[model samples]
Target: MIAIRSSVAQLALLFLAAAGNGALFVIILRLRFVMEQHLKWLEQTYPAGHVSARGEQWYNRPFLVRSLFQFMLFLAAFLSLILLIATAWTHRGEVFGTMPQDPALTYYEEHAARLADGYETLSLETAHPALLKLIDEHFEGETLAILDVGAGTGRDASWFAAHGHRIVAVEPSEAMQTIGKHLHPSPDIEWRLDSLPELADTSASGETFDLIVLSAVWMHVKPDDRQQALETLVSLLKPGGRIYLTLRIGPSEPERGIYRVSEEALNTQLAELSLEAKKLDEQSDLLGRSNIHWVSIGICAATD
Candidate 1:
């Protein structure tokens, strides 16, 4: 859904860029042709060895020099335009910000039913032991407020709600949220249609939480938007609150709009926010794929 829109937008931009460049190239060639025709007329009107009133030869040298300079200037401009396009393309995520639609949301919308069942089958104890341990250690015996971003099917949200926590489950995909609501009809868990790098609705509610969970969700965010996303998440946290993230590490599924997650980049962003993160645990892929893995991280907020 969202992915298709993003692709179309990108294609449109590419087409416009190519068309503009082509038009510019044609105009330059036309100008060159006119200049050549004018020069030819001047040459025929004035003999080769004719000198101007300033005592300079009228034909060969001056014409060649001027033509060479124009050619060089056009060539430089063309090359510079190419370079500029390349740079913009490389940083398109930053330049364009969030896409009109997110591919990951589309994937979830398409696979909501199957994903809900599969997610329900996985045991939380096995799937997220490290996060559970950190939660117990930091927030044990307390009925804390929790924000579960990307809470597809409400699996984690249900678990937290059952454990005496108030939960706000934010899922952007309407399909996923529908299935999630049907599966886990809990009074303690509040569901909202929202998404990351913004979470505009959640932010607008003026709610703060003790714990924010992003389970298998960060990789879907573009690198350029991660900083803003992190800041938004931090803003939703209460003083001394913590954020728990499970980062998927491996080759990305471009079809699913997954990007490679970088721990170093996450750490850098944390530092910029005056926060500190610690590695909670690292584990092989639970789905038994040989090439994939997960790293769990915990970021604690300063209690000033």
Candidate 2:
């Protein structure tokens, strides 16, 4: 998503620069033609060596100088166009992806405080009972390492930390991270600025976890990218480690970058990753929105 935004912004600037230069090139050429015509009139109408004719000659720059200036403008315009083409080509995948901007990121950035507050109002037990139950069944009596992707406001991370599990909380929104850190100051929870489809920093840290939580985050990923996203998640899991994911099953909210999610599609992705679903359950939306529901999935890798 960040790549998409950067590519789009670069393309827009290059386009504007190219257009501006092209417009200036046309304007200068027309102005030069008019000035040359006026100078010819001065030369024909005035006597040789007259002040008006001499002044016209001075105003009329040498042909080489005029051409050089025009050539520079043309070159600038041409180069801008070339650069625009090159950049667009280089980032074609990102620029032409399902979305130009991450609507979810935009919404979270704009409404971080409100959303964080609302999220905080819902207890983890109330919001993710199925996931918590699955976790208890799989990881009871163990203090496990956990990774919480899209750990907004650190609600779930804090919960895991409170239960004696160490957590790495990955959140892309700076505003949300700030509020989350302030709200949940547990030393067991390590906060990171990262996103899915590529958990760059988290992946680079060479850390594998016993559990990876993707609570209500997968829907924001484009369908084409979900496979890769699942791959990345699996890579971060230790052998036999589980992934507790909650799919938001509802209408597509294009404005918020939400997409349709289904258990079938998720199962396909899990199968491709050689993961087995340990728990699959559906629940009503915690907030009680009629059009929205949730699917909780717990998948585990083969033991080493």
Best prediction by TM-score: 1
Question: What TM-score fits each model?
Answer: 0.67, 0.67
lDDT of 1 by residue, 1-304 (tens): 3544554566566656656655666676688789778767876888675434332565556556556655665565566567567756743553466546467877887788888888888877888998789888988888899999999989888899888999999998889999989989999999998888999999999999999999999999988899999999999999878899999999999778799987898898889988898999999987788889999999976443
- Residue 136 of model 2 has an lDDT of 76
Tens digit of per-residue lDDT, candidate 2, span 214-275: 99998998899899899999899987788889888889998888999888888887887777
Q: In model 1, which runs have C-alpha deviations exceeding 4 angstroms?
A: 1-99, 302-304
Q: Each model's number of backbone clashes?
A: 0, 0
Q: Model 1 RMSD to the real structure? A: 15.5
lDDT of 1 at 203: 96
The Cα error of candidate 2 at residue 193, in Å, is 0.7
Per-candidate RMSD vs. true structure? 15.5, 8.3
